[model samples]
Each structure stands twice: as structure tokens, then as C-alpha cells.
Target: MSEFEWLKRAHAYDEADAEDLEGRVIAALRTVYDPEIPVNIYDLGLVYALDLDEDAGRVDLRMTLTAPGCPVAQTFPGTVEEAVRSVRGVDDVHVELVWEPPWSRDRMSDAARLQLGML
Candidate 1:
């Protein structure tokens, strides 16, 4: 094969690997629960975005809490970072707390809503 074809294959492999890594990272996030809520962070819809840099083995998570004055506000971000860092291939994790759109009950997953009896 030509060099360009080889590079294309390598890039495709990296993208697939990135996708798998993203699934693992999400699974890790699912293990983290909100101190006051019974639901895991992922199902709770607190996570706004998940970005992975496979080349650097870095994961960036953008999230928010149910409310601004949540009691675990100080520690929640750290908890998320720790969870993501525990993933097998994650070299670094950055958790950013955003409040731009704010969190609402409607943001939660249907399962989460059902669990809380909202549905």
C-alpha cells in the first residue's frame, strides 16, 4: 500500500480507539453518584460534553450540578476527575463545571426520571 493509505488506516484505527475509550470513560462516569441524588452522574444528565484526545490520552468533561448551591459543589468536580482518571487508558482528566444553560429536571435521562418517579 502507499504511504498515504497507511496513514489513512492509522487514523481510522485511532478514531475507533478513541470511540472505545469514550465508552469506557462514560462507564466510569456512571459510577460516580451525586451525594444528594440517588442517580449516577451520567444518567442524571449532569454531563454536558465529553472530549477525548487519544494522542495525549486526555479526557475533558464538561458538567453541571442539579443546582449551584449543591453541598458537594467543592468535591464533585474532583470526584468526576478521579472517576475518569481511573479508566484504563486515561492519562489525564479535566472536569469543567459549567452553568451557562443551567441544569433542569428535563435534562435528565428518561430512565433517571423514571427512577425518581418523574415519569
Candidate 2:
């Protein structure tokens, strides 16, 4: 599916199984950290979107790094893909790195801000 379609479908996860899997996927996402950041990518506002298809056992994720030139940019998506694929019910994972809209501190979670002393 197109990235926009995946993003639009992400909010339609209403099935109980889908919710459970989504939660697991989010938990899995929380385990991945930016090499230069102390906080996980999720809290750091790096994850732009997540679409999970329970029936297909697939996950489509959109994320970004702190900067386009970050050293791990080339390999970070693969790392995220591996993390999502490790979830029990997930059989396929596609991680897309997006620079459009660009990351800013405003996207960060309150907890992340507090942790980083930005709050």
C-alpha cells in the first residue's frame, strides 16, 4: 500500500486482535533507540506513522532520524524493521524513512522532553 494509505489505515485498527498486535508493535518500537539519543525513537518523536495489518501479519512504519545526515540513517530503518519483525504475530515489516515535514522538538512526547530536560 502507498505510505499515505498505510497512514490513513492506521487509525482504522478497531479489531481486538489488531489492537493487541498494535500495542505489541508499539512496545517493540519502544525498544529501538537512536544511537545518539538516550530516549527511544517513539518518545523522541521519530516515528511518524505505524500501520499494522493483523490479518496479514504485516506492519508498515514511517520514521525519521534527528537529522537527514545522521550517521545511522542508512541502516536505522533496517534496525527498526528487525525490531518490529521480532514481534510474535508480525511476519512482515516495512520501515520507511521520511524527511518531509522534518522532525522538530514539538513532535516529542512530554516524557521525552522531561527526560531530555527540555521541559
Candidate 3:
């Protein structure tokens, strides 16, 4: 293939592959539960971002707790890291705690709201 054609094909494949990796990362995150909440972190609106480097099997995640002073504050990030690392093809996980645009009920998924009886 010409360089132009190769670049085009690679770009398309990267988008699709990135999406698939992101899906898997989200799935893994959904399996993580907040110590005080029945809902998983993903649905609870705690996850602010999930960035994947599929070729490197690395994931860069940004998340937060319901509150800055949450009882599990010190351990939650580690928990999330372990959960994401457990997913197949995810060789490395970086979980960052973000307070910007702090988490709120409005951020929760509709299903999470219903489950929490807020709906």
C-alpha cells in the first residue's frame, strides 16, 4: 500500500481498536463497587475519563469519590486500579483522582439513579 493508504487504514483501525479497548476498560470498571454505595463506580458517575493506549495495553483513568472525605478515600483508587488491571489485555493501569467538576447525583447514569431510588 502507498504511505497515504497505509495511514488511512491505520487511522480507521486505531479508532475502532481504541473503542473496543475503552469498552473493555469500562466493563472492568463496572465490576468495581464503592464501599458505601451499592452501585458500581462506573454507574455512580465517579469515572470522569477512561483513556486507553491499546497497543501498550495501558489505561489512563480519571475518577473521584462521592465525597472528598469518603471513608474509602485512601483505598478506593487502589481498588479501581486492581479492577482495571484484571481485565484481559490491560497490562498497566493508572488511576488518577480528580476533584474538578466534583461528582454529583446528576452525573450518575439513569440506571444508577433508578437503582439508588433517586429517580
Say which candidate scores most in lDDT: 2
lDDT of 3 by residue, 1-119 (tens): 85334433434433444447777667667767788889988999999988889899999999999889898888778878876776657799999998898888888999998998999
For residues 1-119, could you state the per-residue lDDT of candidate 1 as single tens digits?
95334433433433445458887777677767888899988999999999999789999999999999998888889878876776667899999999879998878999899999999
TM-score leader: 2
The TM-score between candidate 1 and the true structure equals 0.82
Candidate lDDT scores, in order, read: 0.80, 0.81, 0.79
Clashes of each: 0, 0, 0
C-alpha lDDT (0 to 100) for residue 76 of candidate 1: 81
Candidate 3 Cα errors over 4 Å, as ranges: 1-19
Rank ordering of all candidates by lDDT, starting from the highest? 2, 1, 3
Residue 71 of model 3, lDDT score:
85
Name the regions of candidate 1 deviating beyond 4 angstroms: 1-19
Better of 1 and 2 by lDDT: 2
